[model samples]
Target: MVTLGLVFAGPCLVAQQAMGAGTDEVLQAQLTQIAAQHHGKVAMFAEQLNTGKTVGLDPDKPVQTASVIKLTILFEAMEQVRAGKAHWDEPIVLKPGDAVSGSGVLMFMDAPMTLTLKDALTLMVILSDNTATNLMIDRFGVDAVNQRIAWMGLKDTHLYKKIMKPATEPMPADQPKFGLGKTTPREMAKVMERIGRCELAAPGEPALPGDAAICSVALHMLRNQFYRDTIPRYLETLDSTEEGSGIASKTGSLNAVRNDVAIVAGKSGPMILSIFTYDNQDHSWTVDNEGEVTIARLAKAIVERWSPAGIDGKTLVPGLGLAPVAGGGIGASK
Candidate 1:
């Protein structure tokens, strides 16, 4: 890797490199180059669900969330369902005013279309439906979402407002800096990790508080996501005939920002990858946008270097991390 008198090594990596054990030179170098290829800022965080091996490039740096913030809304809804405060089958009415266009079928539908919270959640992810996303924010209040995030102990993750709407209340000073919402890649990766573990619960492994069923529903919806232009772009299994290997991911994009958070099933186990790019010079919404392609290539590289074979439709144990590392820090650049 091109170490400019300093390297962007995370805690586990730096410690391993010290013991002459970790630091996959070739992989790290490739990852560094991938970040450089983007004409904007990039941040990434990945963890081996089984071994807990991690990789980070500016993972802790806060960045624009775009539609990725919708994940928070989804999560809060899941928690509410678990707490009996909400139901997936609960009906949500879509009025004429709810139609705020960008990405979704709501605008095309007639006024007062009805949909269950479950179905709306699915559309919000699969289609990046701005209208459904706004409906969700209204049903699940913005304050509740922020409170849930705080209760989850995620300081850097915050939802600023509903999509395409003015903020109802005062927001933090940084809200303008990160559009719609804000979160660090590392924090988001941790959230994805929890989702992966929750979905991978073994039989008779006493159900956790959140309920594995909730996790299963969310994962299934993510797997059906319509946007494959980012992380899953260059993958081979996507072209397969059978529903063998599965990938549960949520992708977010703006004209100048692209982000994807996913739990990719691997032969060994699931890998959680959260990557974000902002201030991109290329703002095209095309499938082959440079930023989108960069994320896809980076994802391919991580999977190839870490989980290279077949999944065989088997679930592997979740490995948190091999060993504790020294200090962990994020790398920053102008």
Candidate 2:
């Protein structure tokens, strides 16, 4: 449901010739085919930040956020620090009640341990730590987080409860509609955009001098993202940290849902993308799960089609980054 103002306005208008008309035609055709052939629901929103060329496919449709909504928590944490309501270096003691399962090493560690609020935020984003998330949520106040979302003028984004909260805990009747949290691809993309632009903090709250403070921390944590099964799966600079521009992203995965939003530093400029897959029939958790593979392929296709200039010429083909390699050429699969 993204506006798709330029993509659908009339001609296949492009701000710059990153890629030509013929390539854009093929790319749009492939995206259409991808949406049509996907096994379940798919929503995406992408924009080249400088050029404003864009694409969307059901980008406004509501979807289960899985762990992706932790971003709101991250934003709120940054806000709290800026407001002096919380301190990033404040000490937090881990208790038995704080432990929760799924996608984090915190649960496996000993309880009654201690870490700073900043450390918890790091684990929350980099590891998707449910316990770290819940700890920070308690400090950040769940309602306060939602209020900030509304204040920022986003409607479909909301957090329902702490990660893996019990059924006995008080929550709204619609909690079942979106587990943990919910958001649209477009909304999530905007969140990233604000964070990237360093505009997430409250107005007049002394901006964090040029991505050196909160903005840098948030992006650094995202750049260290441990999960690479989706968005970064196809980028040329997946492993080596220094050779090429890196992907800063957060990914969420549930059995039936896989979502990722990222800010890619393209060779020419920055590009933002958000993609979500849900209601998927294939719920396998394998590296080759259908939904995961779908997102991975779609991400690569978008980059190749729209920003051919950004593509690293020596990288492997779109999805076969791990295939045995010979010195073929730029797009060589093996």
Q: Note the Cα lDDT for every prediction shown.
A: 0.73, 0.72
Clashing pairs in 1: 50-319, 52-320
Q: Residues 209-318, candidate 2: write the lDDT tens digits.
A: 43336666676677667787787787755343433225667889888888999876665556778988887878888988888888888888888766776643222211
| Position 265, candidate 2: lDDT | 63
Candidate 2 residue-wise lDDT at 273: 82
Runs in model 2 deviating more than 4 A are 1-26, 167-170, 201-211, 238-245, 311-334
Clashes of 1: 2
TM-score between candidate 1 and the true structure = 0.83
Q: TM-score for every candidate vs. truth? A: 0.83, 0.82
Best by lDDT: 1
